[model samples]
Target: MKHTPYYLNKPDNILPKGLTNSVFRSSDPLAYHQSLKNYTVTPLLKLNELAKYFGVKKIFVKDESYRFGLNAFKGLGASFAISKILEKDPDIETFCSATDGNHGRAVAWSAKLFGKKSRIFVPKDTTRARILAIENEGAVVEKVDADYDETCEFAKEMSRKNGWQLVQDTASAHYAEIPAYIMAGYFTHFMELEDSIHTLPKPKIDIVFLQAGVGSWPAAAAWYYLNRYGVNRPKIVLVEPIEAAGILASFKKGKRTKPEGNFKTIMAGLNCGIPSLTAWDILKDSTDAAMAIEDSFTKQAIRELYYPTGDDKRIISGESGAGGLAGFIALMTDPRFRNLKEALNITAESRVLFYSTEGDTDPENFKNIIRKKK
Candidate 1:
């Protein structure tokens, strides 16, 4: 629904010196991920037909649905943070966090993996299926009479009072280390892609479209590419639902800011009104652009991935998962985005990459959307 260019005048090929030594840039995270017995690389799919349809050189989609068998990418952050916490405090018995859906389930799954108890707080609007998913992960689910941000505060308070570790993705002055570890854990995805880069049509990707919620995941991506490629890094675009486009609002204001929205979008995983401190710090300087899209566009993208062109593999993307591709489709097809398209240098030779962050996390909604006519 909206597009805004950011950091256009910033010089290219220069390393963000502040982030060069950050956890996201270190090899430790990737090494840690590889040490896990369950760790396996997710597929980086080539969509030649889709590239032809969009008139782009190529399109690569990282299918995160296969990650940890949790059907979402949040497990990467949660597992890493929990593992690091256990290393520091092995006596810790319980962990707690808040979520719209995916993060809480991830925390639960990670806690279970570590043989610790988990208490997950979720917004009142979270779907029943997601709640059951968290419960199935062996977490005690608490539905708060509040939105995502308020629920986060509630969970933090509960964790403090109960002597439980708060495994939240967002960072505050009092809590930065765990969030950093979580972000570092997300580096594994990029590392996996790097290993397979030799097999791609091009060794380097021209652009990357990353979907954001509280911004942690995309921040990890931006930090990785910025530190690794320096001035030659791919153009990174942040995508979010227009109703909860906190990252985009922050981009326009040139500082951290919250957005006011009805919070009824089908992209439940991206319905956060606040941006994380660590994420904002990295994204504000590193990313190329921010896009806010409507639910209709995400639905269209889900259908497009499920029903692919030619022999392209089918990807089961949820509302939030399809956001990156949704943003790409909007830029290419909508006349309103022509200027931004040109501004980002999107052309027939541009090799674009997208992350499908989830796979039908909300099964019923995904089914209904897929059943509807395009």
Candidate 2:
């Protein structure tokens, strides 16, 4: 089947009533993170030049490249989930998980920090840099000749056989609480973003563009914003690579559904074929719209961030990290996506927010893309 870009607005009839504030009272996993050495909040950069280019009032990006020194936001979730798991079973000897890249590294890092052994599984096609990064964190790397979804299954089996604590980010009927903790851990980013936003002169965020893989990050963010702002919550747009736009497919079907095909995309971090069950529960009713974009758009967005035109600050965002910017730029510049722009009410006064979820996680690929253009 030929993949085409598409957008779908959430049906009003199915929109969720606001969730209770109590849900977030003890939900943040940041307290454990703060206890770690050298912990710091990532920067919320205001890209005035990009705002001018897009004809928006403001554009703020939560740069998560340096999160926990892991170079991606995945550390927050992995660390939080693993920490919580260890609290219950202090004698747990091993931890395990499957990843496209960043999440595996986070799991390994957390394992190392807690003085536990870890075994991480990755797809055959995973980049060498990512595998090496995971190994450097003291985890045994197991390469499976399968796609990410298959690797997840392999990891699950391995975890059961070895009695290792599984820290997978996606949830199913059999394994829900751990993934919920993973999602809860992700709240740290939003909590930090909220504090940063309050420091701004104009604190109102009009629209939020979040990129989705299995949908955990966006779900966590959407939940935080929905509860924090309630009726005044900003419009949320979920962006994903066209090849693996599982959440987009689900939204289009008006229920959860998996995307078809190889699920390969340059945005490897977002190359998930299935949406996390817990994440889907939150996004199904909370998101305002969903979008699928081509790999070329993400490439262009990387270059845009690396060498911005006008006075925009240079941002070293990786392919997956730039997907939100790619979707936002597509809506603003591409005639084909003009309707999506209007549907999201992207007016001149709109102040948009995006999360740059990673940096140059794959350094060689980052250099090739940014340097080739130069």
Candidate 3:
């Protein structure tokens, strides 16, 4: 894919000076963590037992489960993105998006933060609690067809016709600038991740398994950490749900990957069928690997984090957010991946990091299954 310049990289950068100072601090072309102070970069907890089981030196999870009241790292992205966009184009009277849950809520809430009217379109299968949660954030909520792609189509079509500023959570060439800004917002989380890494005991980013939703966050993260740390940078592993492995499949396809598909995944954030051109361009030229996991594995991984045996301080982790660790665990348990671990040199000495991207937007639904496990 030929490189079309990012908004941040453009010669006449249209971002206002105030917005640039407030959000666009990072050197990474598509990210900034200037607003990361309010949100906690949840710790990279050492999973000694899991490490031993996988025959690795160390394993850690960058629990994004502690971000603001929302309990997801996504807020960092949407909030920062919306702010800069608003600062640059304050004339935007309305903002809108299509999300499985997280991105829409974050973008809508951030829009409200800037006193803009916002709306979120979701798939029909989305939970009642999710709809209400986004609505409570001062967004008008609408439900479309069952699939995520359908919701995205609805949101885009509506935004175009109604003259609302469309904040498509996924990326596309037609309107790639916003997604680039979104990726820059996501960088703040990774920037926080870089800081948190230094505080960890014997922190060495030999491997990083990151979740993907059109791959914006991880691509921006890869750009930052790899450049900051140099060629010995961590080998990045892109994690997506099995049904939504299009990003990975697309990566291996080089420039030949199709831009359209009918993909499904239990990980709502990973439910995207179309590739974000912004993310695809970045990830294609930079990432180390792309992988996918089953929904059953996602369930177990969530339990491992939130229901740590005998520990009652329940960690608030969203279902889809835990999918990165799930994919990591799958790699650990895989016969084919055993030797690839050697490629990463992930021995007892190697350190790993994975981002927990969202909190349980629907606690009752999360608890419905979780309560039984208890």
Candidate 4:
């Protein structure tokens, strides 16, 4: 996450009407199925101990774990994006997506709620547990041999051939609309985070570390803060797996960059080599910086979640859900991050807001890793 001098053309000013309101409170992910739906996103308890350990201001993880059966913030993007796409021309047959894992699950659950059939295509090596989770939701899963990008192309081709509505998130003119809808669903995330921060004792959120897949959720959340609060907005940091740092690299290079290598990261949700165009557009204007973390660092973050000294069982979160905290820890551990750390003054007073996006979305897999600690 280098922030060298670079220039970007002025960004777009297209704010969706879905974000203008602040009454987010949907208990059912299906009920609030839009870009930004029902949820008073609340500020979870900040670990004063962890804050001091990190030598940064207060660190409060904004909990998105309370969404419909699905826990991660992807609920916001996937549900809303898919709904918007369908609303224009509701497809009764099938909704399709390519994913490392989470996004596909989200779309499957969403399609089920809307009384639609769904199909998910995942890389051949995708864990049976993750794919099974989607199947448990009643959506059919197709396994493809190859990488994430390849699966995505297969999903598109299959959708075209089968007349299914392809709910692809990586942006394009037609697909860009879905990202916009996805971002709209995330407005509640910002609304709830702000509400939670305001409720804190010393409630100034200095920084917000967010993980990016298609980049819509975090980008839209930060954009809402910038538009409504201006200088009051928290410093936004975008995180991704190092192997799939395509968007971050593109932003850093002042031109869009897409990687050809197979994305091999444990943080599946953050493993996209190409990002949503709409999501990218907003991040270009709103983000303060970006960072990437190795899969090893994400594993270390899993340790932090489980090792809550003195028997407080930390909530078992999916690996993808831990991406932001992983990147933050990665940044702190890096020698290059030393100077950036000093410059950012990321101390306990910082009131940093992060997200634990999902819970044990894949239980057996999560248990396998957790059991190893014993």
Candidate 4 vs. true structure, TM-score: 0.84
Query: For every candidate structure, what is the RMSD over all alpha carbons to the true structure, in angstroms?
Result: 2.5, 2.5, 6.8, 4.8
Model 3, 19-123: lDDT tens digits are: 222333542422334434454555657766656655677667666766666667777777766776776888999999999888888887788777899979998
Q: What is the TM-score of each candidate against the true structure?
A: 0.94, 0.94, 0.83, 0.84
- Minimum summed lDDT over a 10-residue window in model 4 is located at 19-28
Q: Which window of ten consecutive residues has the lowest lDDT sum in model 2?
A: 13-22
Off by over 4 Å in 2: 1-4, 11-25, 198-203
Better of 2 and 3 by lDDT: 2
Question: How far is 165's C-alpha from truth in model 1 (Å)?
Answer: 0.4
Where is the poorest 10-residue window by lDDT in model 1?
A: 5-14
Q: Residues 219-318, candidate 4, lDDT per residue (tens digit)?
A: 6676667666665566777777777776677786676667433577767777776676666666776776777777776677677776655433365557
Error of 3 at 71 (Å): 1.9
Q: Which residue pairs clash within candidate 3? A: 30-184, 31-184, 32-184, 33-188, 57-347, 57-348, 171-276
The lDDT for every candidate, in the order shown, is 0.85, 0.83, 0.67, 0.68
Q: How far out, in Å, is residue 361 in model 3? A: 2.4
- TM-score-better candidate, 2 vs 4: 2
Q: lDDT tens string, model 2, 1-374?
A: 35346655653423333222233455657787788886799988888988987799999988889888889989888888888788788999999999999999999998998999999999888999999999999999989999888999999999999999899989877787788777788888777765657333334688888999999888888877766766567788998988888998887777788987567788999999689877888887778888888888888889878887677778889999998999897778777777777778888898988889999999999998988672
> Candidate 2 vs candidate 3: which has greater TM-score?
2
